[model samples]
Target: MLTTTRLDRDDAAVLVDGAREKSVEMGIPMSIAVTDPAGHLILFEQMDGAKVSSIQTAIDKAWTGATARKGTHVYNQLCVPGEPTFGIHNTNSGRFSIIGGGLPVEVDGEVVGGIGISSGTAIQDLEVAEAAVEHFLKVQANQH
Candidate 1:
């Protein structure tokens, strides 16, 4: 069997809005994005005063997490003391940036999507993403 599932604009928008709101609530500007299971951008937004560099980074985080079907930084957990992918910076591509702030979005415990937020400090970025994920899980939980 073969199948593919993608996040719609509305769903993506909700994530962006949720992430952005949380960023604002916490007094930090942010660049937020949602990616489909294939790691393609579904929705993206930049809050005022956010840096441009955050966009690519945010999308990369989401894609890495979603495609890997694990935390974006799974590599870090698996890497050796000096593994090339260890403490990977922006250079490595395809599922690297596992330093928190990015998470896979799942349904029935299977990752079907992901959300990424950047433009703030690492802690702030992770907080925003975490809040969004928590809300998403709650919504899904209520559905069943």
Candidate 2:
């Protein structure tokens, strides 16, 4: 038998809340998404004034993060032409995001979930995503 850890609703909430706070601090409304280890969405939010087009982007980003088990930004470098992972973004029905702001959530060296943010620049979205993950980890650490 195998045992695994996964994020629940409360955990997803923490990620969303953290992302929202950071987005507000940055003066950019954002779309945030949280996903399970399997890349299934657990929670999502789009702040007022956020771009409507970014909603699907956020979800796809989370999907990429969780399923790929790597930050989406990492692919931007590797997914270029002639690279080994070239055309990766074309796979998974085009759900593999090469842009930034998609991050896997790991606990005890195991990926438990993913977080994705959008609506600002890629760098800005990445910053908010990082902040959200950091906040989630801190909260988890304090609870245990």
Candidate 3:
């Protein structure tokens, strides 16, 4: 059987807190979601004043990142016109997204989970998600 790192509740909480801090620093409310490598929801949060519509989008972003094993922006580049993955969003029952703000969480070079943020501009969301992922990596490194 294949073995890989998995995200536990404490790890999920760390990611959520990191994302929340970045969102607050940026003065942007956001919806954040974390998911396991298999795309299973591990935790989710919606900041006050965040748009309700972003809840689902955040979850879907995390799911896409975990399952696809790539940042959503990478998918966006691949799905552009005349690109090899053009129209790839049509797969996975349309659950995949090519927008920014989705990122895989890696531990020792293996993806353990994914984080996604929404309810702000794409850049803001990506920044928050990236901040969360970076914090998680630091925490994991210190644990060793």
Candidate 4:
């Protein structure tokens, strides 16, 4: 049998914390979601005043990032008309988001989880998500 690694509660907590801090710094209430490598939700947080509609969006973005093993913003480019992956956004029961704000988390060069941020502009969401991943990596590096 092959050994595999997945994010646990501690890891998910760190990711959420990172994203929340970034959102606060930006003065934007946000919905955040973290998912395991299989695209299953590990944790979710909705800041005060965040948009209710963005809850599911955050989850879906995390799901897409985990399963696809790439940032969802990349899909925004490839999922457009005439692109090879044009219909990718329609897959996974529409859970495959094609917008920004979803990012895969990797450890030791292996994907461990995903983080998603919403309730702001796509660019802003992406910024927060990036902060989350960066924070996680820094914490991991310090621990190691």
Candidate 5:
């Protein structure tokens, strides 16, 4: 059998903290979700003033990123009209999204989990998610 890395509670907390820091810096209230490599939710948070509707979207974004093993922006490019992955968003009961704000967390080039952010503009969401992933990577690097 093959082996894979997973995020523990502390790791998930680190990711959430990173995303929250970026959201605060940008003055954007956000819903943040972190998911395991198998696309199961590990942690989720909605900041004050964040939209309730974004809760599900944030979870779905993390699920998509974890399962797809790439940033959602890449999926956006693939799922556009005339692309090879067109109509992908229509699958998974519409849970799949090709939007920005989803990013996979990698350790030594292996995707261990994913982070998603919502309740702001697409760019803001993406920034927060990226910040979380970056923080995760930095912490991993320090452990070695």
Candidate 6:
């Protein structure tokens, strides 16, 4: 039987906090979103001075990554010209934010969820998500 693991509110909050802390340390205000393996929202937050427009986009990116089981930017990478799934952004009703900065959160060698950050530059967004990933890895190692 196949099974799936979902992150509790606490784990998801840690994931968001890790991302937010990194962003602030880098002098960037941002928004962070975390989702379960199935891409349902677990928790989300926006830092002071973040753009109001980026809230849902942040969530969408994380949700898309978790649900699609791939980075949202893959849409740009794999959505080649003439690809049937190209322009999925339109097909998906704007839920697919085909951009960098969304990353999957894995545990036990499997994706338990995902993290997404926005409101800063694309690279900043990546930095926050990467920080969350790093925290997850380090915490998991400590549990051994």
The model with the greater lDDT, 2 or 5, is 2
Tell me the tens digit of each residue's lDDT in model 4 across 1-144.
Answer: 978799999999999999999999999999999999999999999999999999999999999889899999999988879878999988978889988999999998899989988999999999999999999999989998
- At residue 10, candidate 2 shows an lDDT of 99
What does candidate 1's lDDT look like per residue over 27-68, in tens digits?
888888899988888888888888898878788788777876
RMSD of each: 2.7, 0.7, 0.9, 0.7, 1.1, 1.7
Question: Candidates' lDDT values, in order?
Answer: 0.76, 0.94, 0.91, 0.94, 0.90, 0.83
Minimum summed lDDT over a 10-residue window in model 3 is located at: 89-98
Kindly report which residue stretches of model 4 are placed more than 4 angstroms away from their true locations once superposed: none
Measured by C-alpha RMSD in angstroms, how accurate is candidate 4? 0.7
The 10 consecutive residues of candidate 6 with the worst lDDT sum are: 72-81
CA deviation > 4 Å runs, candidate 5: none
Badly placed stretches (over 4 Å) of model 2 are: none
Q: Is 1 or 2 the stronger prediction by lDDT?
A: 2
lDDT of 5 at 88: 90
- Residue-level lDDT for 24 in candidate 6: 80
Clashes of 2: 0
TM-score of 6: 0.89
lDDT of 2 at 76: 83
Per residue, candidate 5 scores C-alpha lDDT tens digits across 1-144 of 998888998999999999999899999899999999999999999999999989999999999889988888888878878878999989899988678899888887788888889998877889899998888778878888
RMSD of 6: 1.7
Model 3 TM-score (2 dp): 0.96
lDDT of 3 by residue, 27-97 (tens): 99999999999999999999999999899889989998899999988897789888789997888888797
